[model samples]
Target: MTGFRVLFRAACSRVEGTGHLRRCLTLARELVARGASVGVVTEDNPLARSLAFSSANLSVHFVAPGCLFADLIDDVAVVVIDMPKTDEQLSLHPDWIGQLRQADRAGVSVVSLGHVSASADCFRAVIDLYPSRTVHAVNYLEGPEYLILRPEFAASDIADGAFSDQCEANRVLVSMGGSDPQDLTGTAIKALIDTGVTMSVDLVIGSGYCGDLQAWQTQATAAGLELTVHRDLGANDMARLMRQSTLALVAFGTTAYELMALGRVAAAFTHYSWQEASAQRFESLGAIRYLGCAESVLSCRRIAEQVRQLLADRDAMAAMAKKGQALVDGRGACRVADLLQTYAQETRDRQLDLLYVVAHPGDELMGAGATLIRQIDEGLRVGLVVLGEGSASRWNEPGPSQDRELAQRGLKTALQQVADQLGLSAWYYYRFEDNRFDGHDRLDLVKVVESVIRRHCPHTVYTHHPADLNIDHRLCFEAVITATRPQPECPVTTVYSIETPSSTDWGSVLGHGVFQPNWFESVAATLERKLALLELYQSELRDDPHPRSLAAVADQARYWGRRIGVPCAEAFVLQRHLAATISEQKHSERQGES
Candidate 1:
């Protein structure tokens, strides 16, 4: 166990189909670099066979479709499945997954790696592309490994002048898996010629011997494009190539994530699949240039032209490579490694306990929602209990007051705005008398929250800042104090609002007035989102019939922001450390956690 001997089982068949095995090979190399005895077991999909032979630290063990689980588990302290959730992911076949579980039960730690391993609970440790929500790890499972990108990507130390010679400068690799059992390589070569000029061209052919690799080699040579048919390069080499090359004409698959990790500027050309849907966002981020697939060689001319343009601009390509690297650090594999290491080192019986309560829509949105989204995105266990009816009974509009629906519409919109902007979980709202927080029974408020805490047992609770100017905000704060009072041992981290423009005096909100705030927190990263959320209070803006309030709130935050040297910031009055409540047990727990 000290010097772990790990076996990586992967799915590698086609050129495009090789990401799973490729990344697994990357991980194996990482372990080998770390001084572990590493080996690989693959379906022997032709794409993966080369990896077995490439690394000195890796010993190859080939298995056929019908290989039994016992045969797959030979000489392995831990079995790491390196199959991602691409359309070509093959390791999760029921038979293989079942075998891995059996191996785990037999005391061989099962570590599942790849984007595609969804049921994390089934393995001792499951590593993936990013933090996963679809698979619950910290709770039901032993460990959750985050996909670690390779170091070659993070270091960005591309061999100085990997393409120094102008004659060999325009090199690119437009390689995917070998599922095309259809001879797309010949068409791709034809398409490359159609696009423009380049002396050195890397023709990546992985495990898929769809047709004759020899024939494609012949065609590639005839085109005068130096075709390097690499059947045996590890993921580390592939990552190097993605970074060293001026540009890559690739598809929406594991290669994309790898290039994204390497921060290699790439132009995507896909036929169509689930991966394509996510590619739209990748394109928006300028990580990829999209070109739809070609049914035949006739349609690849356009694809070639696109690749041609990228080749012409090395500077632009370098910029994209940096951007891609920023988008994904090769930490995914390391993330998985750490998780597995921790689990292999420890065993525990843990309980998830919590006490969570929140004020209705506006309070949660304006301040708490941003932090909540950050927590949720990290795969934490959390929920909110909002206390307010969807009514604006306390609102004092200049014009004729409207019905409950009309008044609450703005609040609802703002709440929705917070959720959408922060990508937070669906909120749970209650119809309590709004603007009348002062009248809500302290005991009743506490009781409702206490009931929720007992039901969910949340480890942390977030609430409105206790000393805020808004009467409603104050009450929301008080209710949480009362709820957590009984369960003094439970921990609740409280977060308060930066006074909203709607809750302020018109004079101060105008920015020229004297009600300027002295307190602020850098909300620079979330400023646009905050701006957008403020719009949700359409009722507030429309209440005056002038829509001046909309601009007023922004002006106030901006004024404070300018004073603080930040682009934008939200103001807060934190009194959680008041002398009177200094030693209060409830206050003590909420003190440092928040």
Candidate 2:
């Protein structure tokens, strides 16, 4: 019941090819496996119908060609579209752009699978599966790492296929994709025959293949090559055949990525100009050899020469397998599913007023407990993110004990209890090891924080002061600052760094890491609640004179409160404040004058 519904609006036809539908199905299956309700909306084509019938629990709705079923999209959390962003292609579905915009306006996330002609603002993300050397915009998730392939194609260990020179039959897999308009399967078979090498050929044809399969078989047999023509095989069977084969000759499409995922060397031929461009990118990566368009008379000879060259070198073949597998790890469907699910959840969640980034579960309360309670009392939606588990640092041994899991569960329970007590709108926890913040790449921490910031879009952020004695606190501060940079897309306008009890006081003893307070919030009313909340973190609390103890916490609050002429107060360092723009300030001034 917690899972949301995802709808795919795609096309699959003789002219459009089945790649869109196939990849969408792969992603849909992954999402469903992870507890999402998935549906596909496409033209009432035979391919779509057959796939829908074959895939158990998959819902496939049909619509007119070049039509988007806007009515079918009700109650859907996400809509994934796979269409080219070309003028001619956009003309095919006139209402697609408008429908997509309307869906986006309705708070439904729209994700583009490849290239889509819809306006950029309509899409929550553009996941480009094609290979690219250059960096894309932030919203576009490009390259082979995001390439969606069937789960069956995933391989754990890639063993190099022995290129047997003495073997009578060298296995060559030829697939021209669904509906090979240029008869590339036939072209590949003819090229294999021309290679003059005795081989066992597996001709995998698709449901959309309009070419004469009998002619391909006859030609292969006449040329003294073993031919096995497989028609519309299931993904598992196809993956099995691909694993058994030594090399694959495929058209530039989803199959190419699948072959790469299987760690099988491939040589690709393109049927379209865009496909040729994509093929060149693969060629550059050395994962697959590009043999150009199959329509040219010289293309067959080029394919024959490349096959001969690749089949002869065992080392080269092994290297290609490594590069291909490295490029495509077969978890693309999972990654795409993650993108869809994240966008869906982010769209569904309400924005937060303040987001506190801390190094541990209790760090938020330890630093700004009274201030946070005051904000919640004032009707502000507050959230918290703990970057580390704060468990590993407590262990005296080098490794963790069996009690670690139990301890983590207890910590989670305590976090939920704190959330319930503080009336927080949200609370997030990451499993970064406690006390090992310095061991991790700083950008990794930054990226995680950035993802959260982008999701919640909080206006104000509070994090640990950078000069704290704890390394995790310092790293958390750096990550929050970097993640909340003054970008036009970011919603954060102010950031404050709070002082932890022991870490900040101890860090100040080093002289260089002195704590300086520039802002103070009177917490006179919530002082008792802050002390009560400290009871939830009993493990983190200390006795009597320790800075983290209840008595010391109250003493520090009274100390800061006296400086600011209040009964109790929380102090903070104003780390960053993005002042209003001239236009914004003028607008505010005009309203104030009224």
Candidate 3:
């Protein structure tokens, strides 16, 4: 019974804000890609907005917020929260805190997720602005263990790299706050020039400031300090400017943290009271220099000197950069996901259930990658089922000779290397002769897989995914499906794809605008083992593309690492998660009984 990781629900506050939903989506994608199923539980109010903002691949369900204290879902591995809850008064309600505590007590790791104002007592951990020494002030739990800092921002690796022309401009971004009530951009701009910095500025005003900002932009040109203003910097532009900024001058809030993470140090000028407190806290950590309200700070000649001090000395700049990143790691989403996946594996003995059915040489290695690492590191029992001899194609070559057959025999040797790496049982390969297709219809092949399923009676079955574009991958999906449909102990998970088997020759496939989806999986846990298994696929991914090449598989996984926000990933599209009948019900119940 692999549990799911869920995020908390809430309304009011910044329910429509993309920041909260963005974090949830990142974490969900990471956890779900690993073995653990990841679900999100958010309130209806914010969910509508998030739906427009989120990617369809990530699943987030809207449940009422009132059920906070209820033992909602037992199979949940962790609960993450960052939304604004209005059903209960956060300032006065002990119940809100109690709800989080209840989740912690249930052995479900609780993470009070945040970017700003990130201090949590009830959570097992706080995923937020990281590496900041301010995290050291948390009163409970091991600060380091409970504090999951992200790497993208925590380190200064990208600061000295590059910047946009506009970024280097005295472009001062003024995102008033997540929810800017006062619409304070005009006055803030006035105060800045009043300070006599007279630097050219690109103001990032929000969606709500259309008219006022337009008028100010016109005036900005006339005022003559070489000012150009932009309101609501479109997504791409905002990121570009942030990457290439001399400094970001925003009011104290999450943007401050994000800018800091981007290695752009910002000066804070608080408009509201809580902002003042946050500015103070950030200042204590050397994250930013606060200069009273926007109006007053904008009027002083001393502002230029302060800006020069921050800009001239790279040492102080780097230190401040690190301090800001200390608040949270950009990798928070991925790591939290891995943690929950490990939690799901903890139930293995209690549920001697799922058997990951593999095909060919690198099937298991490429598909169930993250799970393989956890299984081997913990010395867990894993059942292996290799479908064929995994031999290379002899379809077009000279009549199959003894030499070619020995290479065919190489499939078993390669598979053994895989098993040895995983510390798992030997391959129960049906030895139906590898890669050389025994002429058969999709249905007949299904029967053979069906026989395997009946004999194993595994609670969960992992196989090739149906929608896979490769020939054998397609065949595996159809066969696995036919074999598992009628029995009680049939494989619960019908399929997963091994991308290597579906390789495209670079010569035939280049210069085409075709989109390839590579599975993003971390084989690090069993990376050595995975490569060993690939050694078994004697005909896999050859560079010359003589019909077998696994290079595409590994290359694609590395490519995916750069996408979906990770370093390395082996991906598999999920096929099923349901109990279709009484037998399916009993199978699940039986898994629990074990």
Task: Name the runs in model 3 displaced over 4 angstroms.
Answer: 1-3, 10-18, 43-52, 62-74, 83-107, 114-123, 126-159, 162-169, 182-184, 206-211, 225-236, 269-285, 292-329, 339-594
Q: Rank order by TM-score, top first?
A: 2, 1, 3
Number of the candidate with higher TM-score, 1 or 2: 2
Which stretches in model 2 have alpha-carbon errors above 4 Å? 1-3, 85-88, 91-94, 116-118, 132-138, 157-169, 294-298, 354-594
Per-residue lDDT of 378-445 in model 1, one digit per residue for the tens?
A: 66644555667435565566443223323454465455455445543223444456666666557656
What digit string (tens of lDDT, one per residue) describes model 2 on residues 456-511? Answer: 67989999987789889999999999989998998999999998999988886555
lDDT of 2: 0.78
lDDT of 3: 0.51
What's the best-to-worst order under lDDT? 2, 1, 3
TM-score of each: 0.50, 0.63, 0.46
Residue pair clashes in candidate 2: 85-117
- Every candidate's CA RMSD: 13.9, 12.0, 20.5
lDDT of 1 at 218: 75
Candidate 2 lDDT score at position 334: 76
**Native-vs-model 1 lDDT?**
0.54
